[model samples]
Structure formats: structure tokens, C-alpha cells
Target: MRRAAQGMLATIALALLTAPSSLARVYLTQDQALALAFPAPASVQRRTLYLDAAQAARAGREAGGAVETRVVPYYVGTAEGRPVGYAYFDTHLVRTLPETIMVLLAADGRIRRIDILSFDEPEDYKPTERWLQQFPGRGPGDELSLNGGIHALTGATLSARAVTQAARRVVALHRLFVAPFPPPSGPAPGKGDGAPPGAPGAVRP
Candidate 1:
């Protein structure tokens, strides 16, 4: 009986040692991601934009997905007192677990980079850096979907879809609320025909 008990304990220990871990893997923090996105000579500013119901609806329509929050936080990079780029951090579920990603955009509202900050799913399900490289330069108008413009990820379809959706949503938000406004052209100063470049009634281009 004693021998049998000892063997059972050994088997249990072996199984525990070989079992897969379920903890979330953290690759980078938000500050680290910001540093990587905007290197030296580029200063980063944190900004928050509140979206009204109408604005949120339009963004959802453009992105083909729901806007998860009305209050959004983003970062802007500037150099030589001129705009450089934008960055947004999105955390969403990939399958039953949560994953956080930082989406970086160029000054023209195109995708520049994507970095996974933390992932709760198995490492195998995370998209590779090679796969993520395809996203750079994609704009809000691009078809950023699975098998549309982005190639499918074998055995990691859910993760791929989640990341794609997040990317689309961030770009849409930038285009709608954060892109630089064009110069006022509809009316002269004090004409009362349209708002000034970035005034209340100004048209966003």
C-alpha cells in the first residue's frame, strides 16, 4: 500500500509539471510601447476625446463594428512642433480571454505598427511579427478583414479577427475625430457661412 501511494504522488507531480499555464503573458507595458512607437526627437502627448452619440454611430458604421467606449484615450507624437503620428491602445477579448494591443498610425491616418502588450490566450494563438508586418500603411479605407486584404492565420482565426477589428476601429476613430483639419475654404473670415477650420461647424476633411 505504501509503495502504491508513493507512485501515485509521483504521477500527480509529473502531470502538474507538464500542464500548460493559463496566466496572461505580458510582453510590454503602455509606456514601453509608446517609447517604441515614437522614438527620440519625437515628443508624445496624451489626449482624450469624447464622442457624442452621432459621432459614435458614424464611427461604428465606418468600422463595421461597435464602438466600445465613448471616452477614448490616444497619444500624439510631434517633432519640430509639427504633428508626427498617433497611437491608440485597445484591449478586447480574443476568445474567452483578454488581449491588449497598441495601434500606431502615421500622420496621414495610415497604420504604422501594431504591438501586442498582453495576451491571455496561449502563445500559439498569438499572431507572429511577420504576419503583423502586413498591416503597416493600411488606411481607414482599406478592407482590413480576414482573407480580404489580410491573409488568414491558420489555427488562430479568432485572434486574427480580433486584432483586425481593433485596427479598423482605431483608424476610423482617428479619421473621424483626430485627423488634422484642412484649411478653411468655404467662406472668408466673418462671412458667417461656415465655421473656421476647426471651429464648431467646420467640415472635417
Candidate 2:
């Protein structure tokens, strides 16, 4: 009987070893996500913002979550010598794994689009496109929490919370850093334009 029990354990281990893994997946790259967020833009420029301690604290309070970093990177899209939109990428853990998403905002500070760049969780936990549609046109003042204005997913509670928090954080960051100062009109500065790095007009290489 002991030998039979040992054989059963070995069989169980073998079955576990042969089972498929739900590992990480790269659904889109930065370039692809940018294209989708800002279709047909004349130019796309990258910029960063460095928040002071006070600013960071206010941002965290506004977002209802911790602001993990003081250094933030955002993108600006332009067309016909006018600002078009801004985009921010946020990556956070869903359950025990990570998921990266891009939150694109219209010039008026409303959420324009959201795209999942990568996910390191089971596919079942990933939110569907239909569910994600609720984010667009939402702004900093909108209720983005689950069951507030956004509906909850049946089985993906962690994912839903992470995404909702990300959206709120990005919008709060935009209101604090980007909305107050609009990018200068006309073509964005090229390399060596002499704008200090992390300044409003600074461009990312």
C-alpha cells in the first residue's frame, strides 16, 4: 500500500509538470501603443516631470494611492502646430503578477484611450476591451473606482482595482503637471533646443 501511494504521488507530480503555464505575455510594444494612442500625429515627443516632495504628496492624496516615484515620463502628440494629446504608461501588480498599461489623455485632460502593453498574469484575469471602454472621456473629477462609475469584473477583482487606481493616478498627475502648462504652439523643439531636461519644453531623445 505504501508503494502504491508513492506511485500516486509520482503520477501527480508528473501531471503538474506537464501542465501548461500561464506566464507573461507582451501584447504591444511602446511604439505600437503610441501609434494606437495618437494615430496620424505629425510628431510625438517624449518628456519627463520631476515632482518635489510636496507635489508628490499632493498627487498621492489626489489619486488615493501612493506615488511610487518622483520622476514621471509622459508623451505629447502634435498636429498642425497645436497640441493634440498626452499619454502616460502605468505598470502595477495584479494579484501576484504585473501588468503594464498606457493611459492616453486628451488635451482637455480627459482620458482618450487605454492600452495594455503587457500582462504577467493568467489570461482570465485580464480585462476585456468591452470592459475597458468605460475609461475614455473620463477626467480627474470622474469616479473611476469600481462600482462608483466603473463596473466590477466578475472574477478579476484585483485587475479591475489595479487599472482603476492607475487611471486615477495618471489623471491626477496630468492635472498637477501637464494641464497647468500647455506645450508651446508650433513644432516641438528638436534636439539641442536648449530646454533644460525635465522642464516643460524639454524633449526626450
Candidate 1 TM-score to native: 0.78
By summed lDDT, the worst window of 10 consecutive residues in model 2 runs over 182-191
**Deviation from native of the Cα of residue 154 in model 1, angstroms:** 0.4
- Mind giving the per-residue lDDT tens digits that candidate 2 earns over 1-205? 9999999999999877654324458899999999887788458998777766676787799899998877788888889978789989998888877899999999898998888999888899998898999999899678889999999988999999999999999998777656745334423332245656654434443
Q: Write the residue-wise lDDT of candidate 1 on 1-205 in tens digits.
A: 9999999999999876655434568899999999999999899998766666676787798898999687788899999999889999999999988899999999998999999999888899999899999899999668899899999889999999999999999988777667775223323221244444444323322
Compute the lDDT of residue 99 as modeled in candidate 2: 92
- Residue 118, candidate 2: alpha-carbon lDDT: 92
The segments of candidate 2 whose C-alpha lies over 4 angstroms from its true place after superposition are 1-23, 181-205
